[model samples]
Each structure stands twice: as structure tokens, then as C-alpha cells.
Target: MASSDTYAAHAFHHSFDKERASGAITLTDVHVQFHNDQGQVRFPVSGTQFSLGGASDRLLFIRHPSEPDWNIYTSDLSILKHPALQNDVQIQRRVQQIKNKRRFTWGVFASVVMVLVAIPLLVVLFMDSLTGPLARHVPPEWEQKLGETAFAQYQMGQDFLKQEESDQLLDPLLQPLLQQLQDERYPFQFYISSDDAVNAFALPGGIVVINSGLILKADSADELLGVVAHEISHVTEQHSVRNIMGTAGVYLTINAMLGDMSGLLAMVANAAPYLINQSYSRGFETQADEKGLALLYRAQIEPEGLVTFFEKLREQEQKQLDKVAGEDNRESIESTLQFLSTHPATEDRIDHLQEQINELPHQNTLDLSLPFTTLQERVKRFVAKEDEEPET
Candidate 1:
């Protein structure tokens, strides 16, 4: 551990009195040892705090749980180099910043509350919205590291498409999106899962998992990229991280991020499965749709792909619904079957998407012209082969 020489400092003479005392204090990365006429004492640096405008603003004001009345002061700025002090300051600064972002002025709140009262079903969206501010404060590097850890845990015991298989299908389609990339924080990654569902989900940071079934159902690169773009919007907007933070209490999430990383790790470990099963809020889904449409526009691709894709999901969902019940009884049973999917497509959502598409101006979009039929066959063949392999 790093240590410093004994430095001259002063503290309260007695734990009970206001009298001052002289002491020689030594600093270490983990502990601060003070020796005086009163004897020796050690305080763990993890709990030590420093701030300005205490007994002596000119000198560093050190406070410790062990010496509540000590009111220690040191002229030597080297004490600030202590790991505990640095970490405490950093965490406080970050927490304050995140908290500040989450707070709004009364004027703004008053105006927003008016709009919110008109929309009560979306109040749940605002309840979860608190997590977004904190999510943005998590440093990109930390976010990436945490996501990789969670993703590793999630990938275990899951059937994912082979790298080559995924690369052949996705790399070309992702080019336009990649070309329009703006954020430098996350190393955006995409993977193809071998699940038999036409769905995709985003992991915290920039990891997006697309099911092979979605790809198999898509007729062209445009359709697949549309879904991929929506999922990417979830990553870029920090929705995945927000969801994770929301699932874990905000206090726990903030504390875990700024204090004990183990709490954060354990929470994500237990919650990773739920993350996969979790659905975006209607509000969150709408935001993703709009942002994803913007992404498609910026990439110079036809934005209508999203509309078509949503319509496709809606059709398939209807077919599934028809298989279970006749059309006459479908309305009564649709609510019960809502639990069967995390991604719920609706006529309203599709119509809203179409309205959005109508607003866009014409663009000479790139035609990827991917060999969808051949690729679909390849995906089918590989999935079947993998499914037949014996587990060793």
C-alpha cells in the first residue's frame, strides 16, 4: 500500500472538549494513522470524508466516524491523494451531478404535471423515468464493463448463432447504421441468437441481441435493419441501463454504481434474465421508434422499413392469436395473451409509425440488395444442425 511520511496536523484535544491538540498524522491508501501525546489511532480511509469550509478552510478538513469531535485539519495537501478521500469525492460529485439532472425547476414541473394529469396510464413511465438520469451518469467505460459482465452471464446456456453466420448476415446490413454512428462512449455490438422468436432485445451499454427468427422472417436488409435500429436506439438512449437501474431500486442502483460494485454486479447477475424478458414501456417504445426512425433517415435508408416490420410482427401475432381462438372471441382473449410477449405490436403503434413515415422527405437511399432467400436457407440449415448436436 502507498504510504506517506508523518505530517504535522492538529485535531480536537479531547473527544469531549473543544480544546485543540497537536498530532503527527501518517497517510496510507487504506488507513490514516494519527499519533499524538494521547497515543495512536487508525481510521479506515474508506469512511473518511473531506470538504471545504470546516474549522479551517485553508487546510484540508478531515472527518472520520471514529473522531466526530476531532475536526482534524492538515496543511499538507498530500492527504487529498489518499485513495479513500479521492474516491469519496468522486462519488459525491457524480451522485450530485446525476441528482441535479433528475431534478427539475418548479415552473417546469408545474407545466409537465399538467400534461401528465391528462395521461395517467403513462404515470408508470415517469415512475421509471427517474432511472434515466442516473443511467446517463454512469461513465461509458464503467457502463461498458458492467454490460460485458452481465452479457457474459446472460450468454451462458443460450444458443447463439455462430460468429461467421452472424457476421455474414449482419455486417453488410449494419454498414449504413455504423456510418451514421455518433456516440463514442459505447462499443456498439450486435449478436444473433438462435431463438425461434421474431424478437430482439438490447443489453446495457450497446449490446443488441437479435433473434435468428426475426432475421429469417425479414424479406430484406431494410426490414432487419429497421428492427436492429430500434434496438440500437434503446442502447444509444440508455434505455437498457435505465431498465436495469429501474429494476433495482434507484438508491441501490446509485449506491452500487458509486460505492460497492459488488451490489451492482449481483443485481445485474440476478436480473439479466429478467432484462431479456422485460418489455419497453409504451413511452419508451415510442421514443425508441422516433429515434430509430431518425437513425434510418440519417443513414439514408427508407424509414418505411420500420412500418413494414411492425406490420409483419402484427400479422404474425394475429396468426398466432387465430390459431388459439376464433376471431369472434379474439378481442376478449387478447388481454390474457398479452403476457405471452414482451414486444406487443398494435394497430395504434403501427398507425403512429406510418404517420411518422409520412412526415419524412424523399431520399436516394442505398439498396443493400442482400440475398435474403439464400441467407434464410443458410440460417435454417445451421440452426437445425446445431439443434441436433449432442451436448457433451
Candidate 2:
């Protein structure tokens, strides 16, 4: 026990004795002195520490250092001889409760952090396998619904030829070419158009249209076969249908992202002119060239005729350029010759075909005789009669 006092400074010392019992603790004669600017005051703080025996025991004790000593037990307020000291213990307990609440808040914050980092990582790990199912999830009717819509849009821009042009100049050449290429394995149709753009194309539903200018431009039968076989490969592999489907999907997805509900409707309404630039992909072009050359070789036609056709077109381009300097007319003509587009240039393709031909054994010769000169004479006579006959 210790005690001290200072009158001028208004201070006093406190002292007490502590003892431990079976499940509680006792404090004897505790003296508490309060000092402020006004004055000093001394009091007796009385309490005996009592604990509820458990895994964790908390005990606090205080007592009065006076002759009339009092003992207080923390278990009950009535057991405390000094009620004022119990109030001090209650105030300390509230401060401790605030600290426990802050700790629980920190625990919740940590759990949220872990979830935020883990969820994306799990998704990335499984994404590859998930995409396959996602791609296949499109409805079964989507292709037909999309196909009809695309075809309608594509037909609006077509230019049909006059009936006289069809019977005379066009049908005479195409009918035989059609019969020559036909196989029981694949049935195809030939549509003649008067488009003079020097272009030819194939469509999804086995429709192959060739322009008269393209036929007149080809000097040899083998070169014409090369072009036909190329279009035939497009039909067999279904590249046109695949392209239409792919383009339509991309169009729809973009419009959907923009929140447009009528994208498909708009696409269907304008499909015909839309297909004008449906260029074959580069891989499809190469595949077609390889297959076309094979078909020519199988038909006993020399691949050199295809090469010769390209040479003639190149020569025509030079003459046209010399006549019209800085003009793009020749360039446009060259574009229709299969040399200036996604397909490999005719020269490069010829080199590859020549290499393949070298590896295969030569077949016994072929005779490809076309009667274009004789057919032209007959067509002139027929047209003259139509012109001489006046309109009814």
C-alpha cells in the first residue's frame, strides 16, 4: 500500500491490496483521489472482482482505503458497496463494444474483395468450351429465315437480257458448256444475263449467271471451262450460302448492339444489290482454282489454254492504257478477268496449275472444236429476218 498528498498542487496518491480467490479476485482498501483546478477531493472506490468461470475470464476490482471498508462484487450492483465505481466500469464496457463492431466490418470487407477477384478468373478458365455450345445455340430455323430474306434483297438489281439475244448469241455457247460440265453427281443451272460489265458470278441456290461480254471475251474453250469450273466449285462447297449466312449474322449482331429491332427486316428488303460485291474469300478462291484446273485436266483440256487467255487479256490492257492515258477503263476490264481481285492472279494460278500438271501423266489428246464462226453467220441471218419483218 502507498499514500501521498500535496495541498498546493491539489494532488493525492492512491493505493490498494489485491488477492485471488477460487474463481474471482478481491481488492482491499482502494483509495481514489480526484484533482482539478478548483480543488482536490478524495473518495473510497469499493468493488471485489467476480468472474463467470469459462474459457475466458474478465475480472476488474476496486476498493476503498478507509477505516469503514466496503467490499463489492461485480456480479451484482447491490453487491457493490460503492455504486459510483460501478458506473465507471459500465462506461469502459461501451468503448470496448465499439471496437468489436469495427472488427466485424473489416471481416465483411475482406470477403467481398476475394469474390471480386475470383469470379472473373473462373469464367476465363472455362470460356473456350463454353463458346462451342453458345455458337450452336442458334435456333434451327435461323438459316432458312435468313436465306429467304437475303435472296429477296439480292434479286432487285439483276438485269435480264432480251429474248432474241438469248436464243442467238448466248444460248448457242452456254447450252453446250452446260451440257459439257454436267455430271450426275451435281446438277446445275445456267442463267444468261445481258450485263456488259464483263463479270460472272455464282449464287447460293445453284444459280450460275454469265455475261455475254465474258463469253465473247474468252478466246478458247478451255479458258471458258476454267471459269465455269471455278463457279462450279463454289456451288459444290456451298461457299455462297455460307458467305450470305456469315454476313447476315454480323449485320444482325451489330444492329442488335445498337438496339435496333428491324435490322433483319431492313437487310431482307435490300438483298439483291447487296450481293453485287459478294467476293469469294481468298481461301475459297484458291480452292476453286485448284479444283477448276483438275476439272480441265480431267476433261483432256490443256491448262495452257487458261494461261493463254490471261496473256491475251494482259495484252489488251496495255493497248487500252496506251490509247487512254490515266484512264481506269482498262483497270475495270482487268478486274473482270480474274486477275485483279481476291483470287490469285491468272499468271500465279497458271504457274501452280502448270506444276500440278507436270506431276500427273498426260492423257491421250482432246479435240475441242467450237462452231462460233458458223453460229455467228446463222444468228445474223435470223436477226435480219426479224428486222425486215415489221412490228404487227
Candidate 3:
């Protein structure tokens, strides 16, 4: 047993005013001495008993019950283990209770913090997997509404060719393909854009648009039909709508997790316009290609038309690359082909289409008798007329 006189502790002393006063407390069998700047004051153990109040592992707290403002705190263990205090049951029990409560409180606090951090982390990690199911829950009518809004916004400043003669010539070529792919749920609306780029895109619901450049570039009516068939499949498969929802879902999930409703609302407001210009993922593009080929097979149109069109695009891409190989305008030339940038690699698509065609039973070549040359001439004339129009 260590002597009480040998057990002294450095501590902070507080009086009724709650001001911290540095002091050393020394313990003896009959009294406790507090030595500070003012003087050495003695507290008789018999007259002044101490109670432990919310102590920690590295610290001990003591105060007189009768004099509530008299408090002492120390991080020294030896003072509590002195011969004069070791046998006190009250002090031992109070210290044990404080330690237990401290551990329990820290455990609860740690658990709560972990749960708060983990919930958002888990959401972000699994967000990609959740996109499909969440997208499916969006109503078809909602998709149509989005599509209508996007189509209206997309055509705001674009030149939409509306000549009756051109429509008459183009409608017959598209009617058969539409008849093959149309369903009661989605009534397709087709549009022709006078933009001089080999591009076509589908909006959510059933809005499909084709560029005049693509039509003029086609070698045959079958190639144009194949392009139309591919875009049709995008609508039929709801790829456009699903792709939009997938993008918006990720955006919304992250913003919601961060507790930013303003950002989320802003995203929702711009969603339709953003989706109008967004490109589909490679997987969605592949699905469209496979389904488009199937649609052609079902319509008795040669699948080779799709393959041939892809081959032509690839050849054109190569020619463009060669032309810009050593030129300073290579970047500009590459950026001009927006269709190639958006679609999957042409070479891969061509190979896949050819593979599908090879699996089918051999058949005679399609009769390429459609007035493709006449349509090209008409497209050229319309483009020339548009170019002649003064810029507003």
C-alpha cells in the first residue's frame, strides 16, 4: 500500500465562480491538501467527502456534494489509488459506472456516424444497377410528354424541310418500313432536317428525325430504309426514354444524397433538352442494331442493306481521315462528323451486321430499282435553295 503523503496529483480546481485555478492536490489519511498560489488549504476527509462525477479513463472528477461549486479534476490515477482512498467503496463504484457510461456513449456515437456515412456511400455504389428498374417505373405517357417537349425545343432554330413534293416522294419510301415496325402503343412521327450532316436520332416516345445529308449520301433506297429501321427500333425498344431516365436517375441520386434539392430541380427542368442532344450508351446502340436487323428480316428487306450502309460510312470516315492526315484542320474535320462521334465504331457495327447476315439462309440480291438518284438530286436542290437563303 502506497502512503497517502506520497500520492499527489496535478489538477484543475474550480470554485463557485467556475473559473479554472491550477493546483496540486495531496492526499493523507485524515485530510486532502490543495496547494495553489493563494496558499495551501486543507480539506478534512471526515467533514468534506467527495463524489465522482462523469470521469473518463484518463481523467478523474471530484466535488463536494454539499458545496456544489467546489470541483476538482485530474488525469492522475495514483491519487485515486492512495492508501487513504483505496478502500472507499463509493469512489470505486462511481468510477466504474462513469467508465461504462463513457464506453456506451462512444459506441452509440460511432454507430450513428457509420450509418450516416454508409447510407449515401451504398447508394452511390449501387446506383448504376438500380437505373434499369427505376427507369421502367416511369410511365410511357411521361416519356411521350418529354419527347414532345424535346422535339419542340430541338426544332426551335433548325430548318425543317416541309415541301409537299419532297414529302410525297419520301413518305412512300418510309411507309412500308413504318408499317413493319409500328405498334398501337407508339404512333411514330418522322421529321426531315435540312442539316448537311450524316445523322439521325430518335427522341423519347416515337419522334424520329433524319438529316437530308444522310439521304443524299445513301447509294440505294435500301440503305436509307436500313437507317430508318434502326431509328425505329430505338423508339420501339424505348431506348431513348430509358437512356434519359438512367442519366437523370444518377444525377438525382447524387444530388439527393448530398441534400441539394435545388440542384435536383434544376436537373429535372433541363432534362428533356439535355436528353435531346445526348448520345445513347454503347449497349443501347448495340440493342438497336440487333433489333433493327431483326426488323429488316421480318419485313423481307435484305439485312445486307444495313451492313452496306455501315461499310459506306466507314469508307467515308477513312477518306476524311486521309484528307486531314497532315492538315491543321484535322480536329475540325473530326468534330464535323457528329454522327460518328455519337454512334458506336462503324467497323465493329459493320462486322456484327455482316456476321448476322452470314447466319441467315442465302437469298437472291434485293432489286435495287428505287429512284435513289432522283431522291438524291431533290435533296441537293433543296440544300442549294436553303444555302441561297440569307442568314437571319
> Can you give the TM-score per candidate against the true fold?
0.59, 0.45, 0.58
lDDT of 1 by residue, 188-248 (tens): 7877777788888887778888877887888777787788889888888877666766666
Residue pairs that clash (backbone atoms under 3 angstroms), model 2: 30-63, 45-63, 48-72, 153-271, 153-272, 154-271, 154-272, 155-272
- Against the unseen true structure, what C-alpha lDDT does each candidate score? 0.70, 0.49, 0.68
Q: Relative to the unseen true structure, what is the C-alpha lDDT of residue 362 in candidate 3, on a scale of 0 to 100? A: 63
Q: Candidate 3: which stretches are off by over 4 Å?
A: 1-130, 163-167, 249-270, 323-343, 362-368, 371-374, 386-392
Backbone clashes, each candidate: 0, 8, 0
lDDT of each residue in 57-131, candidate 2, tens digit only = 222223344522433223322223333333557433543453354455556678788877665554344332322
Model 3 lDDT-worst window of ten: 8-17
Cα TM-score of candidate 2: 0.45
For residue 239, give model 1's deviation from the true position in Å: 1.1
Return whichever of 1 and 3 wins on lDDT. 1
